[model samples]
Target: MHVYYYDENFMYMGEDIISEYDEMPENATDVRPKKGLYLPEYDADKREWFESASEEYIESLQPKPQPAADVTMLKKQVAMLTHQVAQLQRGGTS
Candidate 1:
């Protein structure tokens, strides 16, 4: 069982081996905009995306994590507090 993805040029992207058939979108087209055509291969008994291909494709398809403004603000605050703590520690020692 193997899954294959190819670009418009028909170049192989990769392959996966799975055990069941994952339903594709009704509008699924062989042409992937940035990616390419995706094909799934499965064992005769199991009709799914190839395990390797499914895992890799699924992982690749995930959206990248976005940085949060609050997280950035918190980091800045932490840095400021650290500097203030360092200054206080120095003054207390002096």
Candidate 2:
């Protein structure tokens, strides 16, 4: 069965399996809401916060945008090739 955990102040931490956790942390306690209890504002706030946080986390997991290739490196390679071609035209002597 799944169990929800909370901090000492009754702030919800998260849910996990009691078998998996085995022992709760010193500063944490098991939390079980009363049957039929409902808090619309708290539910909405938590849902919104979780949605935003999930989006941000997913974005962070994505590959970052790479920077463009260096123009200076391309220029140097072009210069080297041009010199090599010129030598080839002049009877292959570098």
* Candidate with best lDDT: 2
lDDT of 1 by residue, 1-94 (tens): 3444544433445544444567433322233223432543333233223332566777788797767987899899999988889989888632
lDDT of 2 by residue, 7-91 (tens): 5444456666666547655533334444432221113223221122355666777798654566678888999999999999998
Name the Cα RMSD for model 1.
Answer: 12.3
Q: How does each model score on lDDT?
A: 0.51, 0.52
Q: Considering summed lDDT, which 10 consecutive residues are worst modelled in model 2?
A: 40-49
Local error of candidate 1 at 75, Å? 2.4
Model 1, residue 7: distance off in Å is 31
